[model samples]
Target: MISIEIPRPSRRIRHIHIEFGTLTLDYQAGAEQAQNVADQLAQGFPELMVTIDDDVRADLPPLPCAALWD
Candidate 1:
């Protein structure tokens, strides 16, 4: 029951796609809002390991992604 945030760049690179596990939030809302959502998830799902992606670009090695989900 762990949650994750994946910041994916849009096709035009105009926005940062914010995804929480299978859920997606408003990309234009910025990190604070995203973090708030993450906090909420953490509080709601107390039994799950919670994590939020730190805006790591997709081009990086898979390590960061792995760390997030794992």
Candidate 2:
């Protein structure tokens, strides 16, 4: 996981960005799984921006990329 901390204007924590590495499932199939992961994380850590780094999108041949941020 990649952790990024950003500062807010109100002197509070802005948002936390968590990046998960290349997931080895079909892009479409893995989306639901990814959402569930994000939801679970949100339950414990509210209002974070969860991101996945599924390298497949970058590896795919010339087409619009898939959405990995939820």
Candidate 3:
């Protein structure tokens, strides 16, 4: 049988968004604090250069986000 796989983003919740142009991380926190999750990812993965966007970009073409989950 052939196996198919779906790629998912590494996020604690569905509200978080990550774009692969330069590892942009975004999260929908409370009204006062909007970038709580994005800050966490940046600190946790210091080896990689990542950016945080306040809003999601809906105009990008669909493509492979990651080669490996880990």
Candidate 4:
């Protein structure tokens, strides 16, 4: 089983928002803030796998929608 490690809050983190369905994690932080958080997490759990994916609304790809009934 692949265990997901979630590090506790530190002085660097400002906000953490989580959503249920997709298990979306939203961190209100920039590159520096994120780096600090990752560094903290790495100290205790060195084996943990951490992935960061930054999303910009403007760069999002358009999805195909269903055609309207005639």
Q: Specify the highest-TM-score model's number.
A: 4
Off by over 4 Å in 4: 1-24, 56-70
Model 1 scores a TM of 0.32
Residue-level lDDT tens digits of model 4 in 1-70: 9999999765322332334455645554444555555565567666554444454244333221201100
Residue-wise C-alpha lDDT for candidate 2, range 1-70, written one tens digit per residue: 9999997555111122344455222332244445555577678866554754444443333211323332
Candidate 1 wrongly placed segments (more than 4 Å): 1-29, 53-55, 59-70
lDDT of 1 by residue, 1-70 (tens): 9999999865221123435567643332234444554566577876444444445554533222322322
TM-score winner between candidates 2 and 4: 4
Estimate, for each residue in 1-70, the C-alpha lDDT of model 3 and write its tens digit. 9998989755521234566656665544332232444465477865644444444444533222321221
Pairing residues by index, what is the TM-score of model 3?
0.28
Deviation (Å) of 30 in candidate 4: 1.3
**lDDT of model 4 at position 33:** 52
For all predicted structures, in order, the TM-scores are 0.32, 0.32, 0.28, 0.36
Provide backbone clash counts, one per model: 0, 0, 0, 0
